[model samples]
Target: MTEIESATTPAAAHRRPASLRDWLAPPIPGSALWGWLGPLFVTLFAGFLRFDRLGVPKAVVFDETYYAKDAWALLKFGWEHKTVKDADSLLIRDGSDAKIWEDGASFVAHPPGGKWMIAIGEAIFGATPFGWRFTAALAGTLSVLILCRVARRMTGSTLLGCAAGLLLAVDGLAFVTSRTALLDVFVMFWVLAGFACLLIDRDRSRRALAEKVEDGVGGSLGPFVMHWWRVAAGVCLGLACAVKWSGIFFIAAFGIMVVLWDAGARRAARVRNPYAGAIGLDALPSFVSLVVVGLLTYLATWAGWIFKPGGWGRGEVAGNPLLRPLEAMPDLWRHHKDILDFHNGLTTAHTYQSWPWDWPILRRPVAFFYTEPRDDCAAARCSREILGIGTPAFWWGATIALIVLVGVWLVRRDWRAGAILLGFMAGWLPWFVPAFGDRTMFLFYATPMLPFMALAVALALGLLIGPARQATVHLARHAPSANRRLLGSAVAGAYLLMVLVNFAYFYPVLAAKIIPYEDWDARIWFNSWI
Candidate 1:
């Protein structure tokens, strides 16, 4: 056995009971195709659900008006340009004479990266529903795969990885957000990829520590660098930031999380003054590899705007003798400053806006598509149109599971649990600060956080179904109550069934497939949901 394996093996043994301790490291076979079938199933299932009727509701749903049209503009001009009113109608009814943007420039909030993505679909399929929402569906489907990889890596169990992927696949919010043409899914995919990369780094770093200790291979070691993996994470996070500024929260959280892992590693390695060694060796290089590289990548996403002479804010500094030098500097630099200001100053109140507390409870879900029906129902009925609500059972159950993880982390100091919680906070909590003012943020923005929440819930579920605790082992012999263990397993299984059933119950609304108004109302359990 490798030295590192020998060293960590004992800890794994201690976690198991004396009976199973001899086989502490279970033999994980190398049936690569069979091993990955679970994650692939999850991905294909997510893909099928997302791609079904993807182009329906044929008009511009919430935010699609901006992104869809901009996507078309981007394809034509290589950058987003302003559109005239009623552009979607014009684009839909035979690609007609749409107004092209003049040299004056149009101001916009958020960055250009996501719209650029939407343009790719438009280039292939034209400015249609399928064209706009294609990328969102693809990203959402891929997130399930990434989550599976992450969970498998963390838990070392294919079962738990499949469980995590299944949980995310059934989430109503994730379902709705995935079907829509929005930037958040892209952000979620990148952030999830970054998290997966960090988890990989953790595993590799721990292995490296084990090797050092096993060989007594330590004493002021040089910077412990894994150049390619860290660089890949930086690139992914940079793309995330380009999608939405909320990604910055992830960069900070994951950065600190990894550094702390380093500290723990040094301690594990028995390094004298491990923190000092880590700071001098790992910190600065990591910052350069991750943060500096990420920032440059984010800037490069604005290249089209930089090159375009008539893009938004492109000529703000033009014509004035004093402003000539500033304008000549770079169009994107000026545009970025303006975009930043717009994001910071956005405190306007919105009707469907809700608080973070309301988020966990799914109190105020934004209805992305709603209609007052004329005569589309059973009982001479008035039907309310519907879309943009979270899966009640999944999210509510996840809240309960998150509470359980807090206790698990406190009692067991389980590093995996802590990592999951860190991701949850990074994606979900920071929005509350911006949410303080009356800004119009929807529950869909919470999409980025849903995977972590689902994972947290899965971790809790894993604990319940996992190997019996040492204390509980006596029950198999002394207590003479097989009923109790059976009951516990039954309860956990029932909860999983209920979550899936609930997801199915809400799937119609989530995908915005037209159903009876009363059926939609039946799904809306809370007044705040409307």
Candidate 2:
């Protein structure tokens, strides 16, 4: 029987598998074709949304002015270099110029990983708006695909997986970040990838534990699985950290999550003293896989600065006699320290700055771009904008869905619910620490938490939709539970429709399409949004 089929009741979900084969079987077996077809269709839709008018307004929006030039400088010098004054206007006018930089490397605060991603697009498309944003768009597109697959694995339902992807596709914040020249999308991609890898590792490790309860390769110690997937997860997480320092939170949260999953797998496999077994067998390798490997991978992303010449701090560290022996390693450490200091001291006021507490609810969204275009629309006045805000219907619904997932996790011991909560909290809650110091923050930083919010919504929908086969037969269709499921399917479908309508209403501003001033004013739903 499928996992959901076996789960006839909430209590049934907690039951141990009947046999070793049952323990090793796929959860909620689904048609192989729908698995591929559903997610890809949703991904195509997401790609269309992200790529549509990706280069609109023709002006560099918000941080693109910094990142596009940084990418061009990185392409030219293998590291960021200082640009000439009025470079934004110069680049916008003649973006293909290679001589925008002066001598000496620029002291970039963030790591080079995200810039490298931007540099790829610039290499092919030149330093244009389309070029810098190509990576973000591509990453966002793949994020939909990845989230679809992850949800499928978690819920064992293709339709629910597609729903999750569609939610992300319609999310205003995700859509905006994906179409802009920004680092958050890249970091979000890596974080999701790392989590996906660990998820696969969870299944594989469980299968390894199912290899013979009493005697296998490790003999009662839960036979050794290479855990290369976990290692790959580490590499992805490390790459995420390289993209943004905020990515470190996932490394910590996911580390604990994986270890606990290992312990749970042992318990489900009926291993003696499962907690002890996890500590002895799973803990050390997990540390190596997640921590040591992640640290090494993060450091490796600095290859250009380590090997190539003319990077900032290389000359400074190499010149100091006391630190010269260690090369620029000291300078790299000092550079990180300086970056930390800058972040800690960042309390200056800004018009668009938002509190972390308000991010999920989106009380204030950063206005990435805005222009009162002369004669741009049918109306006497028009507003062209790229507002960095999320869809209200989706975000508000997800708030309740997330709360429901928390309750489901506590009441039913659903691992999927707990995992989603952990991912969301890791990306979101850390900002509160900095918030206490009155640190300046923006809504775009909430990008990494969005995928998990989408997942929580999908999981709740899965509960509503129930197993695909439950309502397939006549007697099943007439059953009491079937009636509830029918109602749920209607609700789920209606919610999705609501999400689509909400997205359509806000599409003009989200895509930077010129709109009537009255229409744009209507979209500014809150006073804080203006």
lDDT of each: 0.73, 0.84
TM-score for each candidate, following the candidate numbering: 0.87, 0.94
lDDT of 1 by residue, 128-167 (tens): 7887888888889999999987877666556667778888
Kindly report which residue stretches of model 1 are placed more than 4 angstroms away from their true locations once superposed. Answer: 1-31, 95-97, 100-103, 212-218, 221-223, 316-331, 372-379, 382-386, 468-488
User: In candidate 2, residue 209 scores what lDDT?
Assistant: 72
Indicate the residue-level lDDT of 415 in model 1.
Answer: 74
For candidate 2, the TM-score is: 0.94
Which 10 successive residues of model 2 have the least lDDT summed? Answer: 1-10
